[model samples]
Target: MALASLIMLVPVVLVTSFLSGIFGMAGGLLLLWFLFLVAPASTAIAVHGIIQMVSNGSRAWLSRRYLDLKILAIVSLGLLLAMGCLFAVQYSPNKAIALMVIGLLPLLLWIPASWLTFDASRPSHAFACGLISGALTVMVGSAGPLIDLFFIRTKLDRRVVIATKATIQVVAHFTKVVFYINAALMLDAMGWTTVALCIPAAFLGAWLGKFVLDRMSDLQFRSWTRMIVTCIGFAYFVQGTSAVLSA
Candidate 1:
């Protein structure tokens, strides 16, 4: 990456980070999309995983007071189990179809929360969601919606929701990075330089997002999160459709 290109991405990273800080989910997806536009698929996935690991890590740290350790432990156990299974399975899914599924998933929010019988706060349920999310993230690039599903019905405050989700994603994305070890090797000094430059930008964005988060009522935060997530889903849907049609 040239210095000019790196400079160009600074603002993008800052903006996306701000969004991620505010929503705790959408920014990573959008950033993944941006990286996809500029890098190879394997490289994009690897870099996105790394950057998101940092982004979510910072967010989790910021809201450490609200970290849900129980959920993290349960979900991580399930995630590990799912990852172990992946090592034994040999499969190739249709990438286009997978993206479409990811894109359409957020629409589930339209269903009345009452209609969903699952208890998000339960350990069993959290583990189950993590198991599925771990697998889906390997298939698609990210599983923000699936992660959100695990907390949608919870009565926790917005900041806690963001913080807790951030911790879970840190695990998910770290797994993703290791899974694509070959891709990680593609990061030459320039590539890494770009990533390193973005780290602080990501952190700054999270800090600013904290300011925004502090002002919003929980209801407003939840509403905005759902709306933004739905839009991101549609963006992925369109990108997948275009890719399929072009191919």
Candidate 2:
């Protein structure tokens, strides 16, 4: 990456991390879109994974008291199972497919409550959330909307929702980085350095976001999260569709 591009991205990292810190969803979607502009699909996913892992890790640490360990464990098992299945298939994604998948994910949030029955507090539902979200994360580089579907209908408060999701995302993004480690290794030194600089930016953004989160009501949080992610997803879908048609 050029120094100018790297320099420009630091603030993008900070802002996206801040958004994720607040909503625990939209930031990764936006960050991955920016990365896709700069790197190939595999490399972009790897780097996005690294940045998001740090961002969510910090958020999880900040909200550690609210995390549900049992849910995490069950969801992780499902994530592992999904990873194994993908590895067996030797699956990989091209840029258009990834963007289109990401574009379509936000619609998961739009599913009416009457039509949806998922509750992350249930072990069965949590496992399915992990399995589906994990596969989407690996293939498309973001699964915030899919994961949100399971939790949004639950009775858990906003704090628990954010903290628990952050914890799971830390694991999910780490898995993504490992899955694309070869692509990560292909980056030159400057590219690696650019990634390194984004780490602190991500942390700072997450840290700053917690303050705003504390002030927001539960209704405000959920409402804003859905609105923001939907808008971002629509833009990505259009861009992806245009690219596909041009090809």
Candidate 3:
């Protein structure tokens, strides 16, 4: 079983790296959807966060010269504030909040179409977007789509945008990890092993994504990111409903 489990991770690594290469972010949510049948929801979320934080943090650090510090600061602070608010109800999984966020996720998926434009970098919505991404990411396990929606609207340089988002995501999810660990939602020893196994997949995915970022044009990025975000939202909605039901 252990051998087979390791083998199973092969496809997980491949698919995630491929998608993240073709797109521009972590494929954790997509990988989670594929693995949920074999793992608990919280375990999957924590492992996903841990693996990707290391992976994306490294990607961002190496790609720092391209990052827009001003935009990074704006969004990172909002996510932190959101984390503080999330602290109160962080441990509690009020079906109400999850449901509310889950319900709106679909709606928000379409919002970028109307509210998002290729030429605009809407930082005013950065706080609200980061807030939602921060809150539900820990609670329900996926918030990349929420963050990507506003990002698609922004016209920042692709390297700057992708690397910055990678950095912010790591920071945001790192804080959530502490919350989960404190709330006793973290991984066990074996779970930690599983998470460690996932690390290479995530790192490769981020590296491949940065390579893809170099080749993609702004219009190409906007179009492809929207599609990827839509897929992520759908993945989250399905997995989130399963989490609630399984809980």
Candidate 4:
């Protein structure tokens, strides 16, 4: 890695870790932007996904006490199935996808559109969600929110929900990397450079964010959740569609 890039890793790790705690998927967005500055688009997504796995794994591991096993199982199966179809779930995620979502984010923020919830009671259905999440995850750095939307209505403890999502993300990210490997995109020098820089930032950020969120009221948590996802929608809409169009 270049010296400048190596220096960047420290902040990357801290920032990612911090964001993931409050927003399960926020770190991915931050990491994507950082990596986008340093690498190609596909590489940015793959590397950021890996960064999120590590950042979130730390939080989930520390908070294993709060994990909701049933919920995790349901969502995990769906993520796994989605992973199974990684190559087949392709769509041209160009600037158009990014712009469309960015445009919709304002409306989503105003009315808070309903989440397409998943049926946790049915393993088959859960697996279907997982399958789709996994596949899209390859193109999209994070899909845990889609899975979480499915579970959010269940009224589980907030900690348990967060833990389960983090755990499932770890598994799904790991599986997705295998696809990157098969597609020959694993651990390039720049990728490792990003990892080295991002891991510490992510580690610190995620840990601290979790502690802060733990003390927050449910209303605050819900508000922050919407805020973070809104940011992501704008980010994706700008990124995917713009890049594709520009390409």
- Pairs in clash, predicted candidate 2: none
Question: What TM value does model 3 have?
Answer: 0.78
Query: Which stretches in model 3 have alpha-carbon errors above 4 Å?
Result: 1-7, 94-109, 112-123, 182-188, 235-247
How many clashes show up in model 4?
36
* Clashing residue pairs, backbone N/CA/C < 3 A, model 3: none
TM agreement with the true structure for every prediction: 0.92, 0.98, 0.78, 0.79
Candidate 3 Cα lDDT to native:
0.63
Error of 1 at 175 (Å): 0.4
**Candidate 1: where is the Cα deviation over 4 Å?**
1-7, 90-95
Tell me the deviation in Å of residue 8 in model 1: 3.5
Output the number of the lDDT-best candidate. Answer: 2
Better of 3 and 4 by TM-score: 4
Segments of candidate 2 deviating more than 4 angstroms: none
Instruction: For residues 1-247, write the lDDT of model 2, one tens digit per residue.
Output: 5577777788999999999989998888999999898788999999999999999999999999999999999999888888788888998978997898899888888899998779999999999999998998888898999999998878999999999999999999988899999999998888888889999999999999999999999989988998999999998899899889999
Candidate 3: worst 10 consecutive residues by lDDT?
Answer: 94-103
Q: Report the error of model 1 at residue 202, Å.
A: 1.0
lDDT of 1 at 155: 84
Q: Candidate 4's residue-wise lDDT over 1-247, tens digit each?
A: 3467546856776876787787676566566556665555455556666777778888898789988777567767666666666556543333244334333433333343354444544566567767766666665555655555545555666777678778878877776665565322545676566566666666778889888878987667667776776776676666656666677
